[model samples]
Target chain A: MKYTEEHEWLRVEGDLVVVGITEHAAEQLGDVVFVELPELETQVAKGDEVCVIESVKAASDILAPCDGEIVAVNDALSDAPGMVNDDPQGDAWFFKMKLDDMSVLDDFMSEDEYKAFIG
Target chain B: MAEGGQNGDLQRTVLHDLHLDLGAKMVPFAGYAMPVQYKPGVMAEHLHTRAQAGLFDVSHMGQVILRGEAAAAALERLVPVDLQGLAEGRQRYAMFTDERGGILDDLMVANRGDHLFLVVNAACKEADIAHMRAHMDGVTVTPVTDRALIALQGPLAEAALAALVPGVAAMRFMDVATYDWDGAALWVSRSGYTGEDGFEISVPEPCAGAFARALLARPEVAPIGLGARDSLRLEAGLCLYGNDITRDTTPVEAALGWAIQKVRRRGGAREGGFPGADVILRQLETGPERRRVGLRPEGRAPMRAGTQLFADDTADTPVGTVTSGAYGPSIEAPMSMGYLPAALSATGTQVFGELRGKRHPARVVDLPFRPAGYRK
Candidate 1:
């Protein structure tokens, strides 16, 4: 698993990578009320806003961490957005993407580095 | 993002440490480090208030005492409310209007027998106090800095409070009374911003922490924060001081004509003595060009404040802008309140709100998406 400064976490599973916000980001957002995900097969560049998460207080953009083509978007989040707050890294994974460049993943922070960065 | 104090030095409320102790997410609000939400988060807190009771630390709000032989008369000159006939132990919602008929601030004025107790927004308190001091004569405005305010709101508020203070259950909506709690005198009022049956209690600063703890100990009571407070008030269709109403907005334009009782209207006995009376009374006689109305967007994406509104999806000219908006938990949809031309302000009028640079269909609906649960 790797973390981005924007607080999203990515985990490699076979040829696809699952994306979701970190626990710290979920806690900061308070409660997730709505989630707008990107369409399947849409190509996204690193740092592009691929999704939006709306909480009771405000709306925040979820940016892409690595250039990839969207493979599967989380359909479950459409009915239960609070899953992001309840299990941010697991079932709450926003989407799965087919990585176009594995080299881009090296730029992300390790778990320890991410913890230090937030602190 | 929260706005810190002007000079970078954030002020702390009396319940600052208590909030931290409860793992509250503290953020700067109105120059104070206030809790935006606790561990349960804003959504839960909002639902809790609607179902049960929630305690809010509103100590940042300004409390003042206006005292003089002609205090009521002096107050009438600044606000449009008819205070001369306001009986003791009653409260009224009022605003300070400028010479041009714009709202400077909206406040609550409670007649406490010998003096009038005024509660103003934290951000506008300094200017409100100075404005009152400069304009009024024969009255002394004293800021009550040693007191902290706590709001106990929801269906269970009366029962929760009655357990702590015996006579609180009998107080009707808008009733104000003084009660003794733990040897401290508490000024309790059956009024709140959530459109619920609630009480706002003003306790001495030193006792605020203990008082809040005692209330939280009740089975129905939970500690809420500013985030829930804003959402609750928005769901209730209440105006937030700087957001919904501002120096550029007027009561008439904000759909607050009911607050300007008939006693202060053009044909009233006390016709037009307050500041901006000419313009305000004129608007009262003939409606304002634009009025505030509730907006219900058609999708799940929340249309937030600052979102522009157009008459139609293809219209080039924007008709209005959203002032306060959020996904209302009680209403179970994305709701907002914004200003629109009087013709387009009618309920069921089709409109479009520009979100993420695209116009989305919406409708102008009657305010207060959720029914008020006040114990009237």
Candidate 2:
């Protein structure tokens, strides 16, 4: 697993990379009230804003970590956005992206580096 | 959510230490390091306030006393409220108006028999004080700095508060009185920002911590923060300063005409003595071109402040704009209030709020998404 500077986590599985926010990001957002996920099979760039996360306090955007096509999205978040706060890195995984090269994940921070970055 | 850092210059309220102890996320608001939420977060705090009692630290808000025999009459020249006719031990919502009829600040003016006690918004306190002193000749405008204001709000507020101050239960909504708390005198008002049965207590600075701790000792009471307070007031359809109402928004346009008593109207006994009487009175008779109304967003996503409203999805120009918007915990929906053309401000009117570049459907509902539970 790797972490992006925007507090997003990426994990490689088969040909897809699962993307979700880190626990620190979820905690910073307070309570998750609404989540707007990206459409499936949509092409996205590294800096493209693909999703939106709304907490009780304010709204925030989720940026794409790398060039990829969104293949799957967690539809369950629409009905229960609080899951993002409960299990951000697990069940709250926002989307699965089909990346051209999974090796791009190596450029992201490691788990220990991410912890120090947040600290 | 970025936890706010303690800015060295920001002011700290009397309950600052207590909030930190309760695991509050402190944020800088109106020059004060106030808590935005506690350990339970905004959603839980909001729900808690609706079901039980939530204690709020509002010590940063300005409290002032207007003395002299002509205080009420003098205050009448600034606000549209009928302060002169307000019975002793009662409070009324009021606003200071500018020459252009725009609201300077909204306030609560209570008749304390010997003097009028006014509670003004924290951000506008300094300016409001200056405006009062400049306009109200012969009346002494004295700021109360040695007191801390706290609000115990919710359905169970009365029971929880009565446990500490037994006299509060007998007081009706909007009523004000002073009671003995230990060795200190507490100025209590059966009023609050949340649309719940509650009390706002002004305790001596020294006793504020003890008073707050005592209230939280009750099982029904929880420590709420600014985030919940905003959501609660938004659900109540209450106007927030600098948001729903501002220096550019008039009372008539803001749908605050109800706060202007009939006695101060054009045909009443004391007519048009206040500032901006010419324009405000005319607008009162013939309705303003634009008016404030409640907006109910279609989906789960909140139509927050600054979201533009259009008559249709394809409209290039915005027909209205949202002022205060949030996810209302009590109503379990996204709620907002904004200004729209009088023709488009009716209930059931369909409007589009532009969020994230996409126009989503919203309805122009009546003010206050939730019915007030005040103990009248």
lDDT (0 to 1) per candidate: 0.91, 0.94
Write one digit per residue (lDDT tens) for candidate 2, span A25-96.
Answer: 998998999999999899999999999999998899999999989999999999999999999999999999
Regions of candidate 1 where Cα sits further than 4 Å from its true position:
B1-8
Model 1, B166-249: lDDT tens digits are 999888888899999999999999999898899999999999999999999999999998888988999899999888898788
Q: How many residue pairs clash in each candidate?
A: 0, 2
Residue B35 CA error for candidate 2 (Å)?
A: 0.6
lDDT of 1 at B51: 97
Docking class of 1: medium
Quick one: best TM-score, which candidate?
2
**lDDT for each residue of candidate 2 in B1-376, tens digit (9 for 90 to 100):** 4567766899999888999999988889999999899999999999999999999999999999999999999999999889989999999999999889999999999999999999999999999999888888899999999999999999999999899889899999999999998999999999999999999999999999999999999999999999999999999999999998987889999999999889999999999888898989999999999999999999998999999999999999999999989998878889999999999998999999999999999999997899999999
In terms of DockQ, the best-performing candidate is 2
The 10-residue segment of model 1 chain B with minimum total lDDT is B1-10
Least accurate 10 contiguous residues by lDDT in model 2 chain B = B1-10
Cα displacement (angstroms), candidate 1, residue A87, comes to 2.0
